[model samples]
Target: MTRGGREKDRDDPERKCIATGESQPKAGLIRFCLGPDDQVVPDILGRLPGRGIYVSADRAQIDKAAKKGLFARAARQPVKVPDGLSDLVERLVTQRVIDLISMARKAGDAVMGYEKVKDWLTKGSAATLIQASDGSERGKTKLHPPEGNGGFIGVLTAGELGLAFGRERAIHAALAAGGLRTRVVEEAAKLAGLRGHLPTRAGGHDGGVTAMKDT
Candidate 1:
């Protein structure tokens, strides 16, 4: 972790992204390994054995790396990049973020539904606020985010947030201070950067009533 208590920097170990000639922290980059058939497989957890190729988490960076044969150059061997590599990576990262949130919820460090979220916020137990990207703007505006640069995440969709809470859908949620909260913010930040939009905080009802959409 960094001195301020953030997760370790991805570039700290100096991994090179195939797209950009520059090397950076591994946490901000995605790892890939050449499979038996020479296919490039994403190593989301960075635990895959083998010399790994790295790419920045941004969609454009991944696309350029694949299109320009940068993976082969980095790996020093021919590597087969599947079609839609960016989409695949995005899906994997999104799933990972959702899974982390789900774990937090299961551990009693997370709460969904407007009232529960408000209770946490009112009690000063909420460390971060999460709202769906596609949720109604007027509905999201009702809740104020915690006071801090990293206190709000507005990337995941209602359906995605629902996955985290094990519900049909969710528009609002809050995470209590804990290890899982930190992980969620880190992963969600990456997702937000890749997806290219900040979550909306525009609308909601008194008592945390959120209008969830099916987008």
Candidate 2:
């Protein structure tokens, strides 16, 4: 299972996490590569050249790898790990997710606003539901995500969603079934793992979801 607790596809390529020493889908691990100066560089997009070293998406795992000489061991050379490596990965992954959502919006595969999202959900066109983590609990409860484990994303703030939709703030959004949806969910799962936990749903009728913030 992925960090998001979703089943992994058997066909997905797997990599060993230097932190956990466990094999998982490449998407569930953050890739790192050795730079010219032997610095450990995060391959968030998995496009950096050279041999890739992997760590689980969790922030603690990344920190463990950095503190335990795991990266150097994997590279078989001395490697410089930057200060706040987990923070760097979080920022990059968060941006990647936001950028993908923006691309989905431009492609007409994503929509924002309660009415539009609700319409898509009602019509069975929405593949995923997105809500701001800090949005009002009552407002968010009016809508539920599609029927699936990764169908809901409440990890992003209203301000973050605003950036994706080109607005000041966005409370609700939905993604249609497409390649973008898959990418968005996959990346969001990584973000969730890094953050430790996510707001899966409301606790009750009025209670809000609580995030397990990273220390």
Candidate 3:
């Protein structure tokens, strides 16, 4: 499994992380490229032109790469790493995930609100259950995710989820199976790894990951 708890896809292109030296799917890693000024630039969309440098999605790993000069070593030249590189990656990745979720909502492949999500879950139309990480544990426990990999996502906060749904706040949402659903899961796994929302083997409403309780 990747550090994001995602099963490795044999068909997906693989890259070796500079920090851990582990080869994994590119989707589970953050891509970087050298800017015109020889500065290391994050390629969140992975469309940047240049030789790509990869690191696992984990924040600690990114930090290690930045502080330990691993990026320069990988580039085979001195490169300027931005301060707070890991935080920048986290913010960009968070927005990427939010954007994907918004697209899914616009495509009518997603639904929000407790009742709607519950209905989808009951009908077996929901491929993934999304709950705010900071939502009330008791309230979140009222629903359960569908069975399968990528069936639950709890790394996003209520306000962040609200942004995706064009609301002020949201605690529950469901996604139907589709291309967008797969992308959401993949990007969300990256965000999860960055935010330290590691998946546990068991327990909690968010599939196998532990949910954060808001008091």
Residue-level lDDT of model 3, residues 27-95, one tens digit each, is: 789999999999999999999999999999999999999999999999999999999998999999999
Off by over 4 Å in 1: 1-12, 198-215
Report the lDDT of model 1 for residue 169.
85
Per-residue lDDT over 1-215 for candidate 1, one digit per residue giving the tens place of the 0 to 100 score: 32112556554676766777776656567788988899999898889889888887778888898999998888888778999998898899899999999999889998888777788888999989888766777667777788764578777877789998878888889988866887777677667646754433542223333445432
Residue-wise C-alpha lDDT for candidate 2, range 1-215, written one tens digit per residue? 58734679898788999988899898788999988999999998899899999999999999999999999899898999999999999999999989999999999999999889999999999989998876777788899899876789887877778789998778889999875888888888898888777548752222354322211
Candidates 2 and 3 compared: the better one by TM-score is 2
Clashing pairs in 3: none
TM-scores of the candidates in the order shown = 0.86, 0.91, 0.91
Winner by TM-score between candidate 2 and candidate 1:
2
- C-alpha positional error of residue 139 in candidate 3 after TM-score superposition, expressed in Å: 0.8
Provide the overall lDDT of each model, using Cα atoms, as 2-decimal numbers.
0.76, 0.84, 0.85
Candidate 3 lDDT at 7 equals 82
Give the range where candidate 3 is weakest over 10 consecutive residues by summed lDDT. 200-209
